[model samples]
Target: MRYLKVIAQDRSGKGVADTLHVEFYEGDQLQRKATEADRQRLKSFSKTYLKCAWFNSGEGEDRHVRIFSHNPSADGTPETVRLHFHEGPVIAYKAAAHDLDNDGVFELILSSDVDNDGRADRTDRNRVRSLVREFLRVGW
Candidate 1:
């Protein structure tokens, strides 16, 4: 499993000071297909949010989704969406996606700070669940 560090930012190009960690596991890394329960969970979560028709994969056919919090205080410029992706301590947003397993399936596991509160809580899990569902709906 590979890890990416995503730092949410606010308008004015300031970091939200919250680091959200996500793990990317290729199908080969997991060595298994998504379980039935996983599929159900994904379905349930995706139903809670409207289909994201405006999501831009940005020059790739890998099928992906980007989710972020709307900062009302920042005039809704999607400051949170302008995330800084890092590998270890190094910024590496350019090569963010890879077919590590060569099986064409990659799983992203959000580790913490799903709610951007700098702490793990129930809300974080739910947010992660929703994200997983949405990702599977569009990314897989």
Candidate 2:
């Protein structure tokens, strides 16, 4: 499996300069710089989703994509969306939320990963369309 790191910040009158950084990796080694097309795709996605702070995958054996969003409040925690993939199809979707009750721990809300028939769930595919289409264009 491969990994990609995408850095994007909100620039919608937030007094922040727009910037994008993309890098691809195979294993622990950097493969190469992102192409112009890859940068464009990330830019377009970031434009549509201004809350996106950054997105990347875990190192080594992790085969998932994590998208981190900006926090709305200064004292609030940011949300993270994870797309778990097996082979190529996205098998699970998970969202981590801030602690609403002022607890020290955060909360993780999971979408159903399996149906009654024990098959991988694809219902959340639409929710992570950008990752599937732009990054991993397989098993769609």
Clashes in model 1: which pairs? none
lDDT (tens digit, per residue) of candidate 1 on 23-78: 23443252333455555644443343222111112222122223333233444222
lDDT of 2 by residue, 3-99 (tens): 5544443335453425545556666676765677665556555443223222223222222333333334545443333433322235334433343
lDDT of each: 0.33, 0.39
TM-score of each: 0.28, 0.37
- Cα RMSD to native, each candidate? 16.7, 16.9
Task: Report the number of backbone clashes for model 1.
Answer: 0
Model 2 clash pairs are none
Residue 123 of model 2 has an lDDT of 40
- Deviation in Å, model 1, residue 20 alpha carbon: 15
What is candidate 2's local distance difference test score? 0.39
